[model samples]
Target: MSGLLALLDDVAAIAKVAAASVDDVAGMAAKAGTKAAGVVIDDAAVTPKYVHGFEGKRELPIIWKITKGSLFNKLVVLLPAAMLMNAFAPWLITPLLMLGGAYLSFEGAEKIFHRLFPHADHEVEEDMDVGDPVHLEEARVRGAIKTDFILSAEIMTITLAAIPEGAFWMEAVTLALVAVAITAAVYGSVALIVKMDDIGLFMAATARTGFGRSLGTGLVKGMPKLMVFLSTVGTAAMLWVGGSIIIHGLDVLGWPVLYDTIHRWAEAVAHGVSEGLAGLAAWATSALSYGIFGLAFGMILIPLVTRVIGPVWSVLTGGSKPAAH
Candidate 1:
C-alpha cells in the first residue's frame, strides 16, 4: 500500500510539472508573438497583393499553397536553424537580428523611394501577359514563399530572442507554437482579405434585404480603401519595428547611447501624463523616434541597394532580381 501511494504521488508531481511547462510555453509564445507583430502585419498586408489578378475561385487555393509553404519555412527550415543558433552560437542572435532589422529598414525605405520616383515595371507587364494561369500562379506562389521565408526568419528570430532562458525543449516548444500560431494568423487573415470582395459581390447581388445589399456594396467599395490603409500601416510598422530592433540590438552590444537617449525622451514625455497613461505615452514616443530613425536609415540604404546590391545579387543568382518588396 505504501509503495503504491508513493508511485502515485510521483506521477502526480510529474503531471504538475508538465502542466506548468505547458503554461510557460503558452505565455512565452504569446509574448514572442507580440514582439513580431510588425512582421506579422506586413506579411498579411503583402500576401493579398500576390492573389490580386487571380480568378476568384483560385484565390483560396493559392493562399492555401502559400500557407503550406510558409509553415514549411517556419517549422522545417527556420525552427531548426534557430535551435542550432540557440544551442551553439547564442551570441550571434543579436547581430542576426540587427541584420534583419536593417533589411526591414531598407525595404520600408525602398517603398518610400519608389513612391517618390515611381518607375515603370516592364517585368510586371511581361508577367501579366503569361499565357497560362497555372504557370503564373506557380511563379507568384514561389515569389511569395521566398518573401515569406525572409519575413519568417525575422519573426522566428524575434520570437527566439524574446523568450526567456529555459530548457532546450521548452524553447523548442515555445518557438514551434509561435510558428504555427503566427502562420495561421497571417494566412487566415490574407484568405479573408482576398475573398472579401467576392463575398461582398455575392451579397450585393443576392442578399434578401435592402440593408444586406447596401452592406455588401459598402464592403466592395470599402475593400480597396482598406487595402490602402493596411499597406500604409504595414509600412509604418515595419519602419518602427525594424528601427526599434536595431536600437535594442545596439544596446545589447554595449552601445547604449541611442537606446538611452530614446528611453530618456520617452520617459520625459511620459512624465507629463497621468500615471495610467504614462506607459502609453512612453511607448508612442519611443515608436515615433524609432520610426524616424528607420526612415532615415532606410533612405540611406535605398541608393546603395538599388545601385550596388541589386546588381551583385543578380550576378550571383544568374537571374535578374525580383522587384523589391
Candidate 2:
C-alpha cells in the first residue's frame, strides 16, 4: 500500500509538470504569434492572388497546395535552419531580419508602384497564360511554395526573436506550434476569402427568400471591395512592420537617435488627445514615419531590382526562370 501511494505521488507530480509545460508553450506561442501578426496579415492578403485565374474548383486546392508548401517551408526548411542559427550563429539573426525587412519594403513599394502606374503587372498578365490545367496548377503550387519560403523565414525569425532563451525542446515545440497555427490561420483565411464569392453566388441564385438573396448579392458585390481593402491594409502593414523593424534594428545597432526622435514626435502629437487615444496617436505617428521610410527604400529598390538584379539573376540562371506570371 505504501509503495503504491508513493508511485501515485510521483505519477501525479509528473503529470503536473507536463501540464505546466503545455501551458507555458501555449502562452509563449500566443505571445509570439501576436508579435508576428503584421506579417501574418500581409501573408494572407497577398496569397490569394496566386490562384486568381484558376477555376473555382481549383482555388481551394491551390490554397491547400500552398498551405502544404508553407508547412514544409516552415517545418522542414526554416525550422531547422533557425535552430541551427540559434545553436551556432545567433548573432546573424538581426542582420537576417534586416534583410527580410528590406524585402518587405520592396514588396510593399512594388505594390504601391503597381497601383500608381496601374499597368505594372501587365508583364505578369502577359506571361501567365496557360493551356494545360495540370501544368498551370503545378506552376502555381511551385511559385506559392517558393514565395512561402521567404515569408516563412521572416515569420520564423520574428517568432524566434520573440521567444526567451529556454530548453532546446521547448523552443522547438513553441516554433512547431507557431508554424502549424500560422499556417492554419493564413490558408484558412485564404480559403474562406476565395470561396466567399461562390458562397455569395449560390445564395444569390438559390436562397429561398429575397433578403437572403439580397444578402448574398451584397456579399458577391462586396468581395471585390473587401479584397481591395485587405490588399491596401496588407501593403501598409508590410511597410509599417518593415520600417519598424529597420528602426528597431538601428536602435539595436547603436543608433537610437532616429527611433527616439520618432518616438518623441509621436508622443508630442499624441499629447493633444485623451490619454488612451494619445498612445494610439503616438503609435500611428511612429508607424506612419516607418512606413514612409519603407516606401522610400522600396522605391529605390524597384529600379535596381528590375534593371540590375533581374538581369543578373537571369544571367546566372542561364535565362531559365519562372514565367513571372
Candidate 3:
C-alpha cells in the first residue's frame, strides 16, 4: 500500500509539471503571435486579391486550399526547419530574419512604386486567362503556398526569438502552439473578411426591419473600403516591421549607428513636446526614418531584381522559377 501511494504521488507531481509546461507554451504562443502581427496583417490583406476574378463558388474553395497549404508550410516544412535552426545553427537566425525583413521592405516599396508609376505594372490579365483554370488554381495555390512559406518562416523565426530558450521539448511545444494559433488567427480572419459580403447580402435579403436591412446594405458596401484599409495597413505594417527588424538586427549584430542615430534625432526633436506625447513622437519619427530607408533600399533592389537578377535566374532555370520548388 505504501509503494502504491508513493507511485501515485510521483504521478501527481509529473502531471503538475506537464500542466505547467502546457501553460507556458500557451502563454509564449500568444505573446509571440502578437509580435508577428505585421506579417499576419499582410497575409490577410494579400490573400483576397488571389481570389479576385474567380467565380463566387470558387472563392471559398480557393481560400480553403490555400489555408491547407499554409498549414502544411508551417507545420510540416517550417516547424522542422526552424527546430533545426535552433538546434544547430542558432546564430544564423538573426541574419535570416534580417534578410526576410529586407524582403518585406522591398515588397512594401514595390507597392509604393506601383502607386507612383501605375503604368509600369504588367497587368495580370493574360496570366489570369490561362486556358485551363484547373491548372491556374493549382499554380496560384502553389504560388500562394510558397509565398506563405516565406512569410510564415519570418513569423515563426520572430516567434522563436521572442521565446526564451528552454528545454528542447519546451521550445518545440511553444513553436507548435504558435504555429497552430497563428494559422488559425490569420486564416480565420481571412475567411471572415472574404465572406462578409455574402453574409451582408443574406442579411439584406432576410432582415425584418428597415434598419437591419440598411445595416446589411451598408456592410455590403463597406467591404471594398475595408479591403483598401486592410491593404494600406498591411503596407504600413510591412514597412514598420521591416524597418524595425533591420534596426533591431543591426543592433544585435553590433552595427548600431543607424539605429542609434534615428532614436537620438527623434528624442532631440521630441524634447519640446509633452512628456507623454514625446515618446510617441520620437517613436513615430524613428519609424518614419526607418521606413524611408527601407523604401529606398527596396526601390534600388527592384530594378536590379527585374533586369539583372530576373533575367539571370530565368536563364539558369529556363523559366521564372522564383517561387517554384
Model number with the top TM-score: 1
The TM-scores of all predictions, comma-separated, are: 0.97, 0.93, 0.91
Q: lDDT by residue for model 2 over 1-325, one digit each (tens)?
A: 9999999999999999999999999999999998677688888987887887778988888898899889999999899999999999998888888888888888899888977887645436643676588887887788778777888889999889888899999999999999999999999999999999999999999999999999999999999999999888988988988888888888888999989999889989999889879878988899899999899988998888778887788899796432321
Residue-by-residue lDDT tens digits, candidate 1, 162-259: 99998999999999999999999999999999988889999999999999999999999999999888888889999999999999999999999999
Candidate 3 lDDT over 92-181, as tens digits, reads: 989988998888888888888878887533334544565677888887777788789889999989988888889898888888888888
What's the CA error at residue 36 for candidate 3, in Å? 1.5
Residue pairs whose backbone atoms clash in candidate 1: none
CA lDDT, every model vs. true structure? 0.92, 0.86, 0.84
CA shift at 94, candidate 2, in angstroms? 0.2
Root-mean-square deviation of Cα positions for candidate 2 versus the true structure, in angstroms: 2.0
Where does candidate 2 have its weakest 10-residue lDDT segment?
316-325
> Candidate 2 has what TM-score?
0.93
Query: How should the candidates be ordered by TM-score, best one leading?
Result: 1, 2, 3
Model 3 gets an lDDT of 0.84
